[model samples]
Target: MHFVTGGAFHGKAKWVMKTYSASRNMEGWFNLYEAECPETDQFETSLVVLEGMEQLVKKVVQENKKGTREVLQKKLQSWLEWESDVRGRRLVLIGTDIGKGIVPMEEENRRWRDVSGWFFQDTAMAAERVNIVWYGLEQTIK
Candidate 1:
């Protein structure tokens, strides 16, 4: 699978969409972390481990209260299963602002940075190929 990543405004999303559109593979996953989305932003890398753990706890509780835990888990499981079951080439696009320097802020911003970083790490481990986008340029990180 092809995994693409980059910081904000780096054109990772555009590249991923373009690449996916040009490809013939029908099985692919697009995971995007846009700054506009609070959840995505919360998953950044700037937060400490303890902060991340706390945020995860809060998220679990929030999702559970909304009765969305099962649904989200099921979807994640299905994606993992698909990743394993597919025989032909597969593509997975994961976009984030990884290399962007830490944001100078407290609490919320820090939490977002931490979470985003964790998500990127997990995605990279699961992907076979990893590409980093910077200034609209692409670099292979894995």
Candidate 2:
């Protein structure tokens, strides 16, 4: 798995497409918001791109009935496990860096930021290679 992340509009998507030699095909690219993550199945091909994971984390944090960090953590744990267990799936995950910049004034926003930071760390640790794009430049972390 390759984890790519950076600030919004920082060229993460462009870097990912170029790095993976991906074309503009619906079969290879996926928007996580359009699909139900909990019910998503294993990929059959060599590469699969799952974009907008930051939004998914926020959505799960907002939608979880318990509205607790533990619930969000558990859900993310299951989702990441599912991704790791898939056979022959080379996943390119694109997420935004939400923990930086100003601290949120709202409690929920702060919680989301905190949870997203933790989730990203866990995902990065699982990834075989991780990269952060800054001003369209790529820097490898692993």
Candidate 3:
């Protein structure tokens, strides 16, 4: 797994496209901003790019406050296992960094921020490569 995180409107998406778009067998991007949330069985390409994970975390938190972390962790594990199950398969996750700056006043917003941060930490730990993109620059952190 390759994990990339940075502030919104940073160069994360551009970097991802430039770095991985050469592969002809790569899957159509599963962007949470546009499509329905994807399941493990839905991925069927050599390289899988998943964008807008922070949104998913927010959705999970909103719908299942009691089980948000568990649900996401399970989903993450399933994705990781799926990637490992197939040789030459790759998983790239792109998430906007939402844990920075002034804390939100709303309870739900604060919860979303905390859960998203924790989820990102878990992703970074499992990822083979971790990067932070800022000001159109890429910096590998792990």
Q: Let me know the TM-score candidate 3 reaches against the reference structure.
A: 0.94
lDDT of each: 0.48, 0.77, 0.89
Candidate 1 per-residue C-alpha lDDT over 19-127 given as tens digits, one digit per residue, 9 for 90 to 100:
5563322222212221121232232222101111223323544445443344334433444555455455353544555326867476545544555465556657766
Worst 10 residues of 1 by lDDT: 45-54
Q: What ranking of all candidate models by TM-score puts the best one first?
A: 3, 2, 1
At residue 54, give the lDDT of candidate 3.
96
41-78 per-residue lDDT for model 2 (tens digits) = 54555577878877778887787645555664565555
Give, for candidate 2, the lowest lDDT window spanning 10 residues: 36-45
TM-scores of all candidate predictions against the true structure: 0.56, 0.81, 0.94
**Total residue pair clashes for candidate 2:** 0
Candidate 2, pairs of clashing residues: none
Which candidate wins on TM-score? 3
Model 1 residue 34 lDDT score: 16
Alpha carbon lDDT of residue 28, candidate 3?
51
Q: For each candidate, how many residue pairs have backbone atoms clashing (under 3 Å)?
A: 15, 0, 0
Candidate 3 lDDT by residue in tens digits, 1-142: 9999999999788899899864323465788887667987888777888889999998999998687888999989998999999899888999999999999999999999999999999999999999999898999899
